[model samples]
Structures are given as C-alpha cells and as structure tokens.
Target chain A: MIRIFDIAAKDLMQILRDRKTFLFLLIMPIAFTFLFGFAFGGFSKGVSDPRLPVAIINQDGGDLSLRLVNLLENSEVITITQDAAKTLADYEKLLTKGNLAGILIIPTGYTDALLTGSLPPLSLEANITQTAGTTIQSEILAAANRLTSAVQTALIVGQTSSAFGPAFEQALSAWDNPPIRIESTSAVVQTGPKVSSQVAALAQTSPAMMLQFAIAGLLTCGAVIVNERKTRSLQRLLTTATRRSHILLGHYLAIFVLLFAQFLVLMTFGQLFLKVDYFRQPAATLLVAVASSLCIAALGLLIGVFAKNEEQAIAFSLIPMFLFSGLGGAWTPLEYTSATFQAIGHVTPVAWAMDGFKNITVRLLGFESVLVPCAALAGYAVLFFLLAAWRFRRVSE
Target chain B: MLQNAIEVKNLHKAFGDLKAVDGVSFEVAQGEIFSLLGPNGAGKTTTISMLSCLLRPDEGDALVMGHSIKDDQMGVKSVLGVVPQEIALYNDLSARENLTFWGKMYGLRGPALRSRVDEVLEIIGLTERAKDRVGKYSGGMKRRVNIGVALLHKPQVIYMDEPTVGIDPQSRRNILDSVVALKNQGMTVLYTTHYMEEAQELSDHIAIMDIGKVIAYGTNAELVKIVGQMDRITLTINAESGRVLEAWKKVQGVKQVTAQDGTLTVLADDSNQVLPRLFETSALNGVRITTVAIQEPNLEAVFLHLTGKALRD
Candidate 1:
C-alpha cells in the first residue's frame, strides 16, 4: 500500500540520517569480513600452494629410503626438511614447538628388510594436534605401499620365470613401470555444504560478519521504535486512518531492506575484491541473503516491541545478538565444532544461512543444493515476523 | 435539531484498580470548540483517547461523525484528527517529510497529499522552514509542525489533547487561534487542557474534569455564576493585630477577615463599597494602610467554589 511505503520511506530516511547505523550496516561488517578473511588465509586458495614441513630421518641411506624421500618431495603435501639430520629427540622438540608436521624415521637396512620380505621397524614422530601431520602420515603410507608391491612383484617374477639375468632385469623394470595398469577414475564430489581453502576467505567471513552486524544493526531499528513511542508518534498514527498493520509493515520493510542491502553490498565486495565466489549462483545467494536479513530484522522488531526505553532496547538487541551469533557459529565454522555443538548451533538461523553460503562458495553447488538452508531461514523469518506483528499490535492497541 | 459531531456516553476505562475514565459523558455540537478542562492526572487525555478511537472504553462507546469508536474504529479515525500532548514529529525528518507521511496515512495521495502538506506547512507558518529537519528548529517550531501533521487530513472533528503543553507563549497563542479558526470554518473540535485560562478563552462549552469524572459542564458565563458575587481585598497595614481584624469585620458588607503578618484580607459582598469603610475603620483603629488591592471573581473562584480546590491545584 502507499501508506506502507510512506512509513517505510520515513523510517529509512531516519535510519540513513543516523551515522552510527551507517557504520554498523556497511562499514563494520565489511571491515570484519576483510579482517577475518585474511586472518584465516582463505583468500590464498588459488594464489599459492601451502605445504607442511616434515623431517625425513633416513638413517637407512638405502635406495628405498632415497626413493621414499623423493616420493615425499613430489607429493606436494609435505616438503622434506634438513632437520632429518638431527636426532629423534631434536625432531620431537620441533614437533612440540609446532613448526614440524611429522618426522619419518626410516631405520637403517630398511631396503634390505623390504627385499627380504621382512616388515621394517619404521617410526613416524608427529604432532597430531596439527591436521597436516595426519595428511603427511597418509602420504607416507601410500608411498610405502607402492614400493612394497613393486618389490614383491619383482621377486615373484624372478622366481617363476627363470629367464636369463638380462631378461630378468628387463622384466623387473617392466613390472615397476607396468605395461598395463589398473587406471583410476576420479572426480571431486562435495557432500553437503563445505568450505575449502580454495574458497575465498571472505566466503565464510563475509556471511558470518554480515549476520553479526545485521543483528548489531538492530540498535538503529530498536532506537527508532523506542523514539517513536516516546514521542507518541505511534499513538498518533493510530488516530489516523492507517491500520496498525500498516505501521508495523512500514517498520519491518525498512529493517528488512536495510539489512538485505547491507548484505548484498558486503557479499558483492567480497566477490569482487576478496575473490569469494558467492556469485557462483547469484540468484541462490540473493535468496539466502534476503531470507537471512528478514529473519534478523524480524527479531529486531520483536526486541523493539518489547523494550520500553532506549536502554532496554540496546540491551535487548545486544544480548540476544551475541548469544545467538556465538552459539550459532557465526564466529567459527560449525563443521569444525563437536557433533553435539554443531547440532546446537543449528538452532540459530545463522548456521543455516552459513550453510547456504558455503554450499555455493565452497562446494560450488547449484541452486537446488542450497534450498534446505534457504527454506529454513525463511521459516525462521516467518516465525519471527509473526511474533513481532502480534507484539506490535498488542503494544499499539 | 443541530447534529452532534461526537457523542460520548457513560465511557469508562480502568487500569488495574484505578479507574482512568469513569462513566464520563458529554457531547460536542457540530462546529463548536468543546474544551475538557482539568488539572494534571484528571483523565483529560484518557477521555480524548477513547473518543479518538485510540483507547477502547471498558463499559461504553462514542460515535464520531456517526461512526462508533468501538466497532467502526477505522471509520472514526478517518473522520478525526488527534494532536497529542507530546510533540510526536520525527526529529530526523524535515517538516515537509513528516507532513507528507502523515498525510498519506490519513489516506491522501499523489498531488492531493503534496498540496495538503503545503497547505498545512503554510498554515503553521513554517512553509519557509519546511525543508529543514525538525531537530534543528526551535521547540515552538517543532510544536507547530506537530499540530501541522494532524491538520493535513482536514478531518471533520479534531481532538487536541493538551496540544499547547510545554511550548512557548507565542506557539500556544498560535495553536489556540488555529483551534478558533477551525471552529469558524465549521469544523468540530474537542480540545483538552489543564490550563483554566485556555479553556475560558476558547471553549463554547467547557467540561471541568477531576478524578476521572466530569465535575461540571456548561458555558463559561453559566459556570461562572456558580459562585455568587464576592470580592477579596488585601490591606497591607503598618500594624498587625487580631484587634484590627475584628474592627474590619465590624464594617458593612465585610463577611470574613483573616490577618497574616501586617496584611489583612477581607472577603466582602461589594469590594468598592467596603473599601471606603475599610479606610475609615483602619484610621479609627490607628492601623496605617500602606497598600490595598482587590481581586475579581473568575474561573479560579468558580473552580474553588465548585470543587473546594483551586483550578491549579
């Protein structure tokens, strides 16, 4: 209705006039997004390859140990460190200091043991606290498996086919090279919404901070409501031909538009500058963003309706904001949290919004993949909006 | 028969145990300024709110322009404009912006809304300052804009609940004049104020309310006649004595006399006749009259007579 638009226009004009509101809506969200993005090293996904540092203590000095070291270097996961020359004690000290991912200690006679078909006494010293240690250990096991298989095949061929020495040598080389091999068919499949280092750091940082600042931005909306009530503008409005719903819709529309626009600008900035791929599915991202802003703004309206004064309004806006954002994993990814905590985090709409964003930015999924999160957010928006409307009508009457 | 612009019948509202508006009843004939006069906490605002369709009556109802406030609130609201006690204009918005928004709320649109906003801005004498934000204006200017918002619709009945409260004298005068102008233009107005002088100056019909009830209701002259002709005389004498008071009571037409310090006040039927005798009596008593003054009977006296309390009390 024209009346609703008039009310919304008036509220937006008031919000724009407030400098503190402007800061929260755009400036603070973008600043925090950038801060978190760079801090998490998420922006370096395509820029550079980051490898873990590990020491290979090859006391064996055998051909197998040398080949193992070569495998470690070529894997692109762990770079061989010169610390391998130090004793195990020194390597353990480096791991404890958080500088080394792991140390691969190939004992002396490792190749002879492998040639004799004996299990070698190999030890890996690693700091399991860092995930890179786990990754490096896996790479080591895979390399060892390939080498052991090759050696066993050579031995079996030498025994069964008693050709001459030169023929045997040629057969051993052929086995290692493999004239016909079992080819692997591989394609990267992302299960659910997930974030990778390749995903722009802003991918998570922008939505998280936008969710945070959207709630924080309620300070302006709550203040407007309280101020209007104090000035008796709300009571005066009731005396006009305007319905109470019209007045509430006006306020609701203002908060929704402000928050949605704030999110769009920040997400766009992230995509343009920080290389966050929120625009991978622009329409889906916009849907999630709109739903998220609606839910957040509806909550802001409820706070405004319940608060009697400006001080109460501030407290009402802030306490719930911090509690919900902190619990819902706005400051950290829910995926990294304990299973129990992730379940609890899903109780807040922030988690759903983050999931929807991660689907597009990290998994690079299509619109259908984000529907669940977007719908959950919309449900919350509807619930909050209904509550806000009921309370608004009660207080106004 | 002249049509009544608004008819309030036995309206009552209670908050918890406190009866805010208790069985109050009155009517405003079309094209008249009817004033609800009361002191603070006298329920004037509550009564106005009920009639304006902002508050529902607990026991009764009122009809504004034949629209029932209880059932047809939207219809009643469309026909009535309310100026509350507080200056309800948004400080962040310009005068024109506030008026335009309010005009739309009152169902005006497009060119009609703009023209009406312009008309109200001119009427409030703030057309030149309409572009400026209300916060930058003086308190009086903001009050004018507040009233201007209510006038945008030009409704048949306007309810002003202490519209002049907490503003400059000039602004109060301007608002009072506007109310008179509204009545002259054949619009009915229900005005409420705690100031007795404002009620006396503006109302064609006055209802004095107290403790959630209408204590008295009639025209100014009719209400003034409640208290018979009586004048108060204060004599600042050079001497203070119970004997001087007794001697003044002996004078003709002097009904009551009380002396405090060097001043003696005499309540008499006719102050002019009592003055000459008071001078003679004072000379006879060797009480030198340093100064003498007489007070006229007005709304203050009428209120005191009817309620046994001063109008400002």
Candidate 2:
C-alpha cells in the first residue's frame, strides 16, 4: 500500500508542477460555468417571471374581437406585441427572429359569427420550438375558449329575453362578472422550495460545465503515464518489488482524488458566490462527485494504458471529452433537447453525473433520490477500471 | 559452499525469426564485478533484462540470490536493482524525492526510508542539491541520481546497463569509479557496456558477446591469451603510403597487416624482432613512418581474432 501511495504521490507532484494543469482543473471550469450561466440569464437577482412575447392582430374591428384582445392583454404569462403585423408572412419574420413567440389573428366576421351561434376560424402562428413558446400557445387557446363560452351564454340569454343586440351585450357583461366560483379544498403540499428559472439555469450550467471540464482535466493524468513510459521509469518500477497492481492503483487513485478535489472547490464556489443550490443536500452532492470522479479517472487510466505516445494520449482524451460532454447534455439541459437525443445522451456517464447533481440542485431532492444515478456512475467506474487494468497488464507483458 | 549471486543456463529469446539471445549462459559470483562487453544490438541489454526479471527467457531461467526469476519474480525483484540504459529518474521531482519514492517501492519505511534516502543522496554526491528538481541539474548530476535510485535498497545484485552512455567525461568517470567502489564494498555487480575500455578497467570477469552468443568468457588476461602469443605494431604513415600495408604483409614473421586512415597495424609473432624488417619494407615502398608503437594481446585483438571484425564493428 505504501508503494501504491508512493507512485500516486510522485505523479501528483509532477502534475502540480505544471501550470496548465491548474488552469484546467480549477480555473477553466469555473470561468465557463459563470460564462454560460450569465449568458442564459442565470445571474438575474429578481424573480424570473418569464413572460412570452406574442402578437395579436385584430383584423375583425368588432366589439367581440376587441374583447378577445383585451383578455389576452391581461394574461400574466403572455406579453402582447404592439407591432400589428399586416400579414402571416410578417408574423413569421418576428417568430424567426425570436422577437415574438406567437401571433393571434381574429377574422373580419368574428362578431357576426358569435351572434349567430357559430365560431369564426382564428389563425394562430406560433413557434413551439421552446418551452416558453409552447406555454404561450396554450395560454392563447385558453383565452379564446373563455371568450367563446361567454358569447354562447349571452346568445342563450338574449333568446330568453326576447331581445337581441342590447340584451346580448348586457348578458356578455353579466357573464364576465361570474355569480358562482370554485375554491381549492385539498391541503397544500410543499415539494421543496421552488427557484426562479434564472436560478435553475445557473444550477444546470454550473454543474454541467464543472463535470465537463473535470473530465477534460484528466488528460493531464493520462499524459503523466505516457511520460513515465517515455522516461523508462515504468520499466524501472517493474524491476522493483512493486507489482503491476501497485502502479495501476496508484495512478487511478491520483486521478480520482485530484478530480474530486476540483469538483468540491467548484461546487463550493457555485453555492457560496453564484447562489446555486449545489449544497442543498451536501452528502448527496458529495456522493455524486465521488462516484463521477471515480468513473472519469478510470476512463483516464484506460486512455493512458492504450495510448502509445503523448500525441495519442491527448487525442484519445480529447475525442471522448468532446463526444461525451457534448452528446451527454453537459453543454445544455437535456430537457432542451429532443426526447430521442436525451435518451441517447443518457448512454454517457456524464449524463448520469449531471442527473445526480440536478436531483440535488434543481429537484431539491434528498439523498434517497440520488441513489439511482450514483449507482449507475459506480457501475461505470467498475467497468472502466476493469478494462483499464486488463489493458495495463497486456502493455506490461 | 559458495553460491553465485546469479546463475543462468542456455537462456534463449527470439523475436519472430530473429534470435535476440540464443543459447547464452554465464554466472556472476558474489562480491565480484562481472561485465558483458559487446557492440550495439549484441543482446547485452536483453541478457541483463532477463536476469533482472524484466523479461522472461523462452527456454531458461536465472536465479537471483537463489530465487527463480520465472516462478518467483517478486523474489528476484526484491534482491535486484536495475539501472536501465535510459535515465529513468523523474525530472520534475527533486533528487531526494525520487530516492524516497523508489525506496518505498523497495519496501523501506519511516526512519529507514528517510535515512536510506539521505544515504543515497550522499552516495551520489548530490546532498547539497537534493532539494533542487532534477530537471534543473546538469546531465551528469541527473546520471548520478539515476544510479542512486538503484542503490537505495542495497539489493544483493545490481545491474548497471551502459550507465555512462551520453554523458560528459567527468560524469562517466564518476559512475565508473562508483561501480568500482560498490564492488570494493563487497557488492556484486553485473555491468554491461559496449566500451571495451570500461570492461577492461573494471571487470573481474569479462564475457565478449556478438550476435547473441558469448564468443569468449574469462578474466581479461585469460581471454587475451586465447589469441596466442602474437604482438601488435601500429604505424602512422603519410596518406600516399597506403600501399605500405601490402608491403608489410610480405615482411618476415608478419601474419596479417591492415590499413585504416593512413595508419597500418601489423599482427606478427615476435613483433620486436620484426621492426627492422617492417622499416625495411616501409622504406622500400617509400612509406614514411610518422610514429610506431607495440602492444601485447588484449580483448580487442581477441575479438578481432574470433570474429574477424573490430570490436566496434
């Protein structure tokens, strides 16, 4: 065991001497985290009541069409665009440029259709590519439905009163002020405190970027192994009383400990300075960090063992760092991707690590909720370690 | 009963159709300096590698301190210290750091490890600069630390493979002297080098190897005796006197004459008596002799006699 520690200590000492390693291990991860977070509006201090910008084009010029626009104007989730687009083509430009989420157009005969107990076909042009845009579309549909119900009730009241225009208008006014209402009866349930969308973005970006760069920093660990082989220290060690397991275990331990320390420092920075809830459940967060570090370190060892030179080691590490991090939702939230993409992303260990972290930071779940992700990470660690050990033995032979 | 520090019999290793080491065998007694002398690609490093448990021989085994290298590798490794042909020290680490790390691998701990590290620092003459990183040291200083790492455990047998290669003359001299000092202190050493001078100056037993075979093995004088009682005479002639080599071959009692770079070397019996004839032949051929020197038989001549090629060839 002392032999194992000796090898690890020597390697760590070598890595610490390199300034680039410090940059990768701690500096780059934090910088990227803050950069992504601020770019995505995660640093905003106020409550992030994200309102979707939409346009209402009232082609109908009637009281009923005007009433629909008024109702949409009062919605808290949708902000009506003042730019009255003249055509559907005009609305498409706004949607494409991301300046407008959707457009509601009321036809010219909308008021007459309501009086005759038939509905006019209102056209809705909306971009549903994002969740905010989808929510705006649903809110527009709900407001339109409410106006139709009020018009139908007024038509029925006008028929009973033996009056038409004035009686229907009075009925519409009365329907707007409802005589009956429903109230909530069930007990309130607090599923942990909810954070604003801005805070949530910070939570996602901080851990995702931290995990991504942490894996990248493992290239230094792999380079250490290659350097030792080039210097012939590995062959010299083989001639000592130390066994093959000692050298492998020593390198693996060094990579794991170094990455775990990096993760802790970054997570602490997120919690204290950036106001991210990484430490809401400290033990659970640590469990995820350890398991993730173990898996990534084992992967680094596998890269080191198989690579024949420093160039090969760097290439091996970089290829996987980009593939796994980019494909595994480390650059963006998995929820922002397609379902097919999210399923594919889960195949990478990074996704599971991100999931474990999100469970604590975003979901505000306790230790029990993080077990599945931690176990998956442990499984990956075991698999990577076994493969690395096999390759190491073959190389030694 | 006395036991040899290492014993091997008919060791063979092959790479594809090439036999890197073939049917080679030798022994090193306790407390003696044994040298394997050969040119590059002569399998000196391969033989040392097998004995140190870094490579397993295909057909045979070696016993290090009476432990089999094949069955008990750890046992052999515990008693063996190998200084590879390359400088294997970590340059980013201090001299003391490198020693301390290797000492632990050799199973030294606590005060034992500390004292051993200090002792190794002193032995390599780097005690004052032990704290400085090895990369900051001169090439010769790095070479000293490389050897120091091998000596930390005080193993029964130490393998030094061309430790002086690619270093300054002073550093090479320091390492050569240290090998002699180690032998004087009753430690067994198995040294390998292509430099015939190092072998002649330090080895108690010298094995001349070529093409993976031990062409000759014995003490320096004993090996020299194999070439018979012939003496060597060297003459430096003018560049235009190259044809003097053929003339000297015809001289009385001269067996062979070869010329290289305006110098003529003649092997003959009773060379002192042949000097007058040699001068007569040179004068006849209009070859102006600039210098003359005579030497008795040595390893170089033995290798030339056995392989019909110079040692460096």
> Top lDDT: which candidate number?
2
Instruction: Residues A38-147, candidate 1: write the lDDT tens digits.
Output: 77666564432235566777888999778877877887555677654588788666555445556777888988977775547567765332223344556677777677
Clash counts per candidate, in order, are 0, 0
Superposed by TM-score, candidate 1 places the C-alpha of residue A44 at a distance from the truth, in angstroms, of: 4.3
TM-score of each: 0.75, 0.76
Q: What does candidate 1's lDDT look like per residue over B1-313, in tens digits? A: 5499989899999999999999999999999999999888889989988897888899989888999989999889888888888888898889999898888888898899898898988899998998999989988898888878878888899888888888889888988898899889888989998888999999999998988999888998888766566787777887766658888878889877766556676768899999999889878888778898888766655665566555663
lDDT of 2 by residue, B1-313 (tens): 4479988788998878888899898998999999999989888988988888878899988887889989999898988888898989888889989899889888898999999899989999999999999889998999899999989999878999999999999999999999999998888999999888899999999999999999999999999888786887878976565567667777889877766556677778888889889888778887777899898887877877787666773
Local error of candidate 2 at residue A120 (angstroms): 38
Off by over 4 Å in 2: A45-196, A366-368, B233-252, B257-266, B270-295
Weakest lDDT window of 10 consecutive positions for candidate 2 chain B: B238-247
> Residue B4 of model 2: what lDDT?
95
DockQ of the candidate models in sequence: 0.61, 0.59
DockQ of 1: 0.61
